[model samples]
Target: MALALPRFAVFQSTVRQKNYLRYIHEDGEQHGFPQFSGEEIVSPYSKFEIERAKSTTAEGNDNGFVHIRCCYNNKYWVANSISSDSFIIAGADEPNEDQSQWSCTLFEPIPVDGEVGSSTTTTTKTTVHVRFRHVKLGHYLRSLVTRDNYHACVSTSYDRRYSR
Candidate 1:
């Protein structure tokens, strides 16, 4: 279902709010998605197109994330380059790494407009962002849009980056 979709989307963590999965756009150069926080907004590279694992890793044992390639760099995969911080989402001649895979799961669908909350107040849900997890890393994807690093990036798992 996810592989069939194509858009510039980010995965909001099911466990944490205001977190997303993203990569660095260092002046159009390849970079890694290692350290991220709530300092970013959104970038044109944030959007991506998802597809199957694009490999023959076995049939039923394939309980993992899909392959997400940046729409900007159709040749690059959301994987690490040579350096963990410099080259994150780079072009892969043959992609077969764990960092290149992402499992997107929509854990929650926002409530309807007429829905009432625990406080008895009407709720209005607008957007519907998906939840994507890094298969091997076990960290959720997030958009860490920031100004300090023009090549901003997304954190690994939770806001407390080093923690799990």
Candidate 2:
């Protein structure tokens, strides 16, 4: 016999706009806009965090550098760089049981093309394909909000290091 699960009611809140400038610009240095004062506005929900990472080959080496961005409440942390033969899978696919539903999967590292750089200033580019499967409803919802937060942090960190 299979056990039955209870259904929980879902509640929706009114959407409001709040000052996220502080989270966006946690660092003291300002670039695009002036510092924002703590202000509150009506919002349905708070924003979620998300992060992105990249890998590249070093000059004269067959292997490349793999970077995994760290998560932060505020967008201002450096991505921890690592040399590995790994990659992350990202995407969505239809669920097995429900055609109307979708799933997402995080996979292990896959092989990628890498090239060596000649000088320190040199850079190489490569394309990566990611796929998702077996995504859960709860995980998906959480990911939806978290992804944005992660992205903001990664963007800020990348800008600080690469941008002139």
Candidate 3:
């Protein structure tokens, strides 16, 4: 049996005005969503207000997952698309279960993608190797901001020659 997810009895919103989720329009005209995609979208603490995420799908109805909308507007919060992170409020002309719909799930952010496969058979824990120093070990990985022809090992000792 599948494990059940958390649910909120009431979806509430505290806002003075309508919450508009702004996203930088990348390659297309500034307008309605889904057909056009934006570079990035963010629901900042100041601009947008989302105190709680509601699991509409868990209600056993056709809610199909969505952010609890602003109490005043009664619009559904939607992620623009999976491919693009741009976000917009669901319009009444469109269906509630459209691509704008989103579901909440428990997640642990990992360093890199593709390190973990999607299959349920096997699981893997991986970390991405970037130009950063390890705390315990004095060694450095990846070359970053260095003029040396070869990679130099950085020890615990501070050196003006090689900036840490």
lDDT of 2 by residue, 125-153 (tens): 23222111111121111011133324222
| Residue lDDT tens for model 1, 140-163 | 544445565532354342545433
Q: Report RMSD for candidate 3.
A: 19.0
Q: 69-136, model 3: which lDDT tens digit per residue?
A: 32323333343333222223322332243322332111111222223323364654232211212222
> lDDT (CA) for every model shown?
0.41, 0.21, 0.26
Worst 10 residues of 2 by lDDT: 1-10
Question: How well does each candidate superpose onto the true structure, as a TM-score?
Answer: 0.42, 0.15, 0.21
lDDT of 1 at 140: 51
How does model 3 score by TM-score? 0.21
**Descending-TM-score candidate ranking:** 1, 3, 2
